[model samples]
Structure formats: structure tokens, C-alpha cells
Target: MTVEYWRAKIWGLLHDPVLKALHNNSGRGKNSFYKQLEVMKPWVETGKTPDQSGGKVLENILLADYIASASDRSAIGSVTASINYAPGKNREKGLEITHLLSGARQEWKINSHDELIKGKRKDYLVQKEQKELLAKVPKELQDPSIKDDIKKIKQLYWWLWRCLPQATCDLFKDNSLMLMPAETRIPDASIWSHVSMTSALAGALAGYDLTAAQIQRWQGNDELSHPYLAVFSFSPVQELIKSSRKMRDFWAGSWLLHYLSAKVCWQLANQY
Candidate 1:
């Protein structure tokens, strides 16, 4: 945002997730993710034009762009990213990004996801729910012939679900099967709430036309650790409290998985 921050943007090392994954700390010097960030300056500033790269990095760019953009702060809240341009135990190089993002000296709080979902191995995504959907017989689907459509849906579902904690799999495995009904087997609000929050996050980043009712509906979630479900469907789970956490969180899990699957893929594919 400022001249000093721009210096970091130009001279700072790259800290994006994909670059982190690609350029590990195998002791690669200037040949680091930071170098790649420097090389991609034009793309980072002006953004990818008609002729450019594609695939997941581009997807991440779109996500990162929206997240880092000036307009998304209120919706996503004060954000923190694990990625830092500078390397060291506590050098606080990445904090610069937050400050730059916040436009305040020491005003922003950007902590490292040193142990978040980014560089971590993904497991919750490959649960039985997703496997069932993938392994389903041609007859199981309404139209198996819709090959590309089905693949895209399944992939998006996997990414969104994996983004959540592992407990998510245990919560909504049945609902993801698609053979189940909406009420009995479908995911309840408990599970769905997290997904909605995730959806709200991605939607906010993607600049989707979210409605006030939708935002308000997700605000009543003080039931659990946080009220994030306020933007999601966890209210239903709390409304139907049960002794068994297992049964209670099922619908929420399913709803989150399904809804995020639809929303994430739709957002990326339909981005302007």
C-alpha cells in the first residue's frame, strides 16, 4: 500500500502457497518462491491478462488477489497469511504484507499458518463420502454421462472439505454419498455451517453478489466456539440439540461439503 511496502512487493521473496510447495527449503537461494514472485511482478500488479498461465496457481492467484485486495478486509475480517517474503524463525517479514494490506504501521495482524491446511497433507478430503461419489456406478448418478461435470464437482468438493479440520469427515460422510435423502442422511446445519463460512470467505474474496439475508442468516452462530456459523447453516444443529455429537454434526458436515463443492467450483469457473 505504501512505498516501503511496495519495496517488499518488488524485492521481497515470494510467499504464496503454491510457490512454497514448489520451492521447498532444500536450500534454493535466489531461485526461491520469492524469486518467482519477483518475476511475476507484472502479473501480480496488473493481474493475468488474456495470455498467461492457468491451472491451480492461477486459481490461487485469483484467490490471493481477492484476499489481498483492499476491498475485501471487512468481509473476510482482519486476515493473516502463513506466507512471508522473508525467511527466518521470527524475522516477521510476512507481517509486512499484513501491514501493507492494512495500510497501517503495526495495525494489521498477520500470523503464519505454520501449522494450517496450506502445506499440510490433506486427508479429510479423501473420506468414504467422496470415494463413494467417485466410485458410484453409472446407474448411481442421475446422469453418469456428464463426465466433466461430475469430475469437476467431485474435485471441488474434495478441496473444500479438506480445507476444514479432520472431524469434518466424521460429521458428513453419509450425506456426501448422494444416495441419501435430504433430511435423514443429508448433512445438517452443524456440518453445513463451516462450509457456509468457508463459502462466505471464498465468495467475499471472489466478489460474489452475496445478499444481506444470507449474511444475517449466518450471524446467529454463537452456539459453538465461534459465531462464524452466522454466515452458514450451523443454526439448525443447535436448534436440534442431541446428546450424540456424531448424529448432530452429520447434516452440517454434509451441507458444508455439498454447498462448498457447488460454490467453490462455480465461483472459479464463472469468475469474470
Candidate 2:
């Protein structure tokens, strides 16, 4: 077979799992925010703490609220949340995610006055959304602390939506990627850490450039790279990482060597 043919086959192998995952889910589908929370209700009702789930339920809550409030007509959006650290040099500074909520709006190109007004708007929306979402939580699960935790998630989603400017919105509308600052609250060995590490590893494999031929080719072949496309949607990590060798990296960074290299490392780590 030709090199191009092999590349195409490899690419297909790399992306099939991600494609299936993304295609099979949606915000309003069985995987909807309310649906995910419903699945978690039993646990919360049984008095399971967030740490007991290793904060996984909390992660789901965060993702759910984010989709409900910020995903804009689709379960998928250009909400790029990942970690960044210096490559090769200054690695000891550690990976830092963007912490942007309390910062000034000038960097986001939004006027302070407008941001203040928008912040209030978002706050109102959060209040309304929080109450509605919490209402969906079973009364059995509505302990004071659980209610408080969901409220905090509401605030977090609002802060995230507010920090993102119209330009970023437009960019997503145009199906372009927009990198946001890192968040500080993500903990060690958390799901966020896996996400961050996956993303960082993807970037490293791509040399932090998206314009590479392989990525560009994959972008053309698979519409998932750009969130503006109608076919593109968010897939759960559980689905994305399922019984697959290269799916996560392919979905995370398109076509890159890390997709294969990470597969090797994953297998090696699991062997023990």
C-alpha cells in the first residue's frame, strides 16, 4: 500500500473511537446535563462525598453546568481548558492552568463597565439556573452541603462564561480554537490532571502548533476539530478513553506521534 493510504488507515484507527463517542452524545440527548446529574443523584442521596468519588461527580457537575450555561445551542464548544508549562526549559515552574476570573477585563478586550454589567447578568443567570438545576436533584439528595456545592458550581460556570469575551464567542462561532488561562483549583491526581496532562502531551507531540500537515489533514477529514460545525459535539472522557489505543490523543491533538507513543506508555503502565 502507498504511504498516503497507510497514513489514512492509521488516521482512521486513531480517530474512530473519538468519532463514535462524539457522534453518540449531545447536550440534549441521553448524556444531557440533567441526565448525568440524575445518574449521580443516587450516590449523593446515599451520602457519598465528592472525595469518595475522587471528585468525579463534582467534575461531572462542573461539566454539566458548563454545557447548560455556556455551550450555546450545542453540547460542544471551543471551551479549551488545559495546562501550560514551559517546554524543555523552566519545566520546574510546574504546569500552570489559567486563573482568569478575578483579573481585569482589558485582556479580554471587554470594557470594565460592560464587564461589571455582564457579571451581574451572569450572576442572575447563575442564580436562576442553579435553582432550576438543583430542583432537579432528588429531594433525598438535597442536603445542605450538596446544595451549597451545586451553588458553587453555578458560580464557577458563570465565572467561566463571563471571562470569555465576545471575540472568543465569535471565534468559536467560526469554529476556531481559543486558549483560555489555566484554573488553579484543579487538584493532584484529579480528572483535571489527566485532562491537563493529556492536552500538554498532545501539544508537545504537535510541537504546540496546529498548522502541521497531519493536524490540518485530520481537521479536514474529521469535523470535530472545529466546534462550529453541526456534526461536532462533546464526548465523555469515559467514552473517549474506552478500549482504544489512540483515540484520546487523536481527539485531543488530531494526528500526532504522541497518539501512538501515549498508547505505548499506557499499555506499559497498565501491564504492572
Candidate 3:
């Protein structure tokens, strides 16, 4: 609201038809279970190639392998991809979204690395993880061109991230983070709520020096935010639980706004 740049992003995410569908189908399954996924309506951007965008994370290993072995760029010509641009004054919304999204992603990655991949020893663990990842990578990666060249993959991965706005991206490293305790229970999915969960906190940090009171109080539904405090055995999760919130007010406001805004963005993204 403070920045005019987010106007299009906010409006687009809030009004996207995909979000309408998700909003319409909040609780449909057994246990009256709800859908937490907020789809975003995508307004396709032109002039950028998919390769220029973020490489497909799920499919990156294979894609990178093929791209590397290719005699030329033609081999990767039809590969599906998306380019990410960094956010800044020129792209307030992008900055706002990137801040929160990437920050959360970093947490997820860090948690994943610590719990599943490496357990917080980035320099130490990254090399080991990459080696293991190399084993799972398909034969194409065996190519001398691509093998052991994680730097290229990291570069492309970051390139995809470029599409996101920068203001938001910085939230990963900011002080205004949310801290909370929650629990969730659904069929085959029983877990605790997130810690200071919400991308708004990140967004606020990106936009300006937002205070705690700016975000409205959260009304949890299975849809937007979760409700519970059951913890899990994931190795790094306990560490997250121990993680402290540097600022409480910022945490609350940021988490709240981030949730609502992402709801719109996710819906809009799904439409395309």
C-alpha cells in the first residue's frame, strides 16, 4: 500500500481468476480439509526467453545436462524455462515479491540443507551435497562440459530468481522477520505451523522501514494461514524452533501482509 509500484502486483494477484477458483473451493475434501495453495493469475511477460529466465528447478538437473552436452544452444531451444529479474526501484512489486519469496526459499533451502541436504554447513556441506546430487543426476550430466560445473547451474538458478523484485528479495537478510508457533493436521499431512510465517514481513522490509502495527491481525483459516503447534522430527526443524525473532511487531505485520499478497500472486500465477 505504501508503494505505488506494487499496485499492479497487488491488484493482479488479488483479482486473478485462478485465485477466484481457489477462494471458491477453500474446503472441499474429507475432514472438510482446505486448500492452502493460492493460485496466481499470470500475465505473461514478453521479450524474455525461458532460458533467460529461471531454469526449471524440478527439472534443472536433466535440463542442464542436456544443455551442456548439446553441440550448440539449439539442443536447449525448446526446453521450458522462465527468466527471473532482480527487483529494485524500477520494479517495486518484483522487489517486494522477490524479497519475501526468496527469503522464504532461503529458509526452506537452509532448513532442507541442514535437515536433508547438509545441515547448515554451507561451504562444507554444499560440496558434499553436490557430489551426492551428481550421482542422482542423469547420464547427460556426465558430460565433461557439465560435470562438476555447479557454478553454471547456480548462475542460471539465480538468473531465474532475477525475475523477482529485489526489494522483497532482501528480506531474507533483513531484521523484520516473523516468529510464531503453529501446528497442522490433515490426511497424510500432519505438521506444525511455521515460525514467524508470512511473506508480508519480507515484503514490508523490502518496501520501507515498516513497523509492527502496519499489518492487520491474522485470521487463520486452513486456507491462508495454519493453526497448530505440533513439531516434527525433521533434523533442522528443532533448530528453527530455537530460532528467535529479532523483531516481534515487524514479524506480525510482515507475515500477515505477505500471506494475503501471496494468496493473490499464487492465484494469478496459476491462471496462466
Candidate 4:
């Protein structure tokens, strides 16, 4: 087989898992967004004005983006909650799986958070998630079938661990990789987290039937204050590491905490 063919295959193996997890978790309204973008494509490509229906589509897109972009940290006080709310008299509730390989746990020294963060802690052993999410790669890349293309295979390892994570962090503004700052000015939370939270917030705001003036007033002035947003935080790092004997133990505890917290966030996001 050609060297390029093998390179492409390896790339697919690494890329597909992340895409699957993201789609499974955050795919609601994705089709609608794609359709709306398609409708605006012609007008976007040509500098032509849209018709009435097209104009309305553009308006909704702009409104959603504006509401999505606003942040509570700024004086604007964010309208993300308003976007999540839709007019619905009856409420529906159910359980759903939001991600692939979510049920699988990492095979390592520690199993639970208590073991990781408390008691005689062990070194952080690097591990991957379920084989389903992160498929095993060949241990040796120097196979005779691809001896001529060994360089590319070696490069794939660097790309998988370094380049791919950096790209995702840059694109989605997710700093989970912690390779570099996702945002320069306000390097706080992940954009995906913000997107999910705002979606939930919008759903809450939809029921109020607030007037444009009221929303504008809330955005413009800080006087009309009601708890429109809630901030939840996790702390106690020192306590979590009280029993750590080595650097690896602290690292293991932190990773376990982050992994568990992410699972909780995924469930909460799916609930809304």
C-alpha cells in the first residue's frame, strides 16, 4: 500500500473516537444548524440580500450567536439562559447516554476517587480510556510492510498526542488538554462548557416571556438584579492530596477528580 494511504488510515483511527464522543454528547440541533447554514450559503457566497424567510433565518442565527457569546463575567451579564428556554407547557424527563465509552473506567492503580485522593496514594500511571474509545496502536512501527514509511508512522505518534489535542483545544476553546491557553484575554472556561451551560440557561429564560426592553434593561443596567446565572465550583485540592506521598500520587488524584467531574458535567448537560 502507498505511504499516504497508511498515514490517512492512522489519522482516521485517532480522529474518529474524539468525533464520536463529541457528536454523541453535543449533537442536539446540529442538523437544524446545518440546514440553516445551508439556507444562508447562497446569500453569503453572493453579496445579495435574503428574502423574507431567509432574513428570518439569518435573524434567528444572529440572535442565538449573540446570546451564546455573551458572558456573565462581562457587564452584559449573559443571555445564554434565555436561549435555552423554549415555550413548553408540559415538561418531559428521561435518561439518556450522552457519550460513547462513558461506562468504561481506566485500568490503573486506583479505582475510586477516595483511593486516589486519600490514604496511601500511588504514582500516576499513564493510561488510556476504554479500548473502544482509544484503540491500541501497533507497539512497533518498523514493520516490513511499511519499512519505507516508518518516518510517517513515527510522526503519527507526535501528531496524536501533541498536534491533535492542541488543534481541538484551539478550535473548541477547551483547555482540558492544558497544552496552552485556549483564550488569550479571558482564559477561563472552555467554550464547549459555555455553550452547554448557555443552552441550559436559554431554556430557563424562554418561559419568562420577557420583553425586548426588559432584556435590554437587564443587559444595559445592573440595577434590575435577579439570580439569572449560577456558578458552581470544586475546590479542596490540598485536602484531596493530604495522603499523597509522591508527585505521581498528586497527579493521579487530580486526574481522577477531573475525570469524575467531567462525567458529572456530561450528565448534567444531557439532562437539560
Mark the 10 consecutive residues where model 4 has the least summed lDDT: 82-91
Query: Candidate 3, residue 61: CA error in Å?
Result: 17
lDDT value, candidate 2, whole model: 0.29
By TM-score, who's the top model here? 4
Ranking by lDDT: 4, 1, 2, 3
Q: List lDDT for all candidates, in order.
A: 0.30, 0.29, 0.24, 0.33
lDDT of 1 by residue, 197-242 (tens): 3334443332323222222232343221111222333345544544
Reference-based TM-score of each model: 0.21, 0.24, 0.16, 0.27
For model 1, give the 10-residue run with minimal summed lDDT.
178-187
| Cα RMSD (angstroms) for every candidate in the order listed | 18.7, 22.1, 24.4, 22.8
Residue 101 in model 4: shift from native, Å? Answer: 30
lDDT-best of 1 and 3: 1
Candidate 3 per-residue C-alpha lDDT over 121-211 given as tens digits, one digit per residue, 9 for 90 to 100: 2333233222432233334423445322444333322322232122212323322212100110111110011101112222222233221
Tens-place lDDT digits, model 4, residues 121-230: 21211112222112232334323343335465545444444454445444344444331211212323333333333333333332223332332223433232122454
Rate residue 63 of model 4 by lDDT. Answer: 36
Q: How much is 3 displaced in model 1, in angstroms?
A: 42
- In the range 1-272, model 2's lDDT, one tens digit per residue, is 12222211112111111111111122111111221233234333544322233332222222322332222222324544432222223323333333234433321211222332333433432332234433433454334343325444333333322332232334234211132221212311212222233322222232312232332234334322111112323345456545357767646654334466677668754662
